[model samples]
Target: MIILGAVLLIAGFFLGITLLTTAGFVVLIIGAVLMLMGRSGRSVGGRRHYY
Candidate 1:
């Protein structure tokens, strides 16, 4: 999700697509939160690992 977000963000920036940029930012934030939750020993969506 992080990687995907980054790709979308860069693509959006270069392509001047506001929608993609917004989506990428949202996805990146969500992915980071999930990763943090996983690291803190919490089960994210019943999964031990997010990746």
Candidate 2:
């Protein structure tokens, strides 16, 4: 997810789309948070408890 967000962010920057860049940044933050929470053994909701 972070990788995808980074890619989108780069693309947005090149395309000069301010909104896309902002959205990409938001996605990147969300992905990082999710990754950290998963590593900490916290479930994002569901019983699987796996990324």
Candidate 3:
């Protein structure tokens, strides 16, 4: 998730696509949040715990 977000972010900047840029920012924030949640050993989106 984090890797994909980073890729989208970079692609957005280089491609100069406004929509991609917005989507990338959103994805990046979500990834960061998920990463934090996972690191804290919390479950997100389902019963399976993040790890």
Cα lDDT, all candidates: 0.93, 0.83, 0.78
Which one wins on TM-score? 1
Off by over 4 Å in 2: 47-50
Predictions ranked by TM-score, top down?
A: 1, 2, 3
Give lDDT tens digits, candidate 1, residues 6-30.
9999999999999999999999999
Error of 2 at 38 (Å): 0.3
* Alpha-carbon deviation at 20 in model 1, angstroms: 0.6
* lDDT (C-alpha) at residue 15 in model 3: 97
Ranking by lDDT: 1, 2, 3
Candidate 3 lDDT over 4-50, as tens digits, reads: 77888889899999888888888888888887887787778873454
Q: What is the TM-score of each candidate against the true structure?
A: 0.96, 0.83, 0.76
Local distance difference test, candidate 2: 0.83
Off by more than 4 A, model 3: 47-51
For model 2, residues 1-51, the per-residue Cα lDDT tens digits are 798789889989999999889888998998898888877887776633435
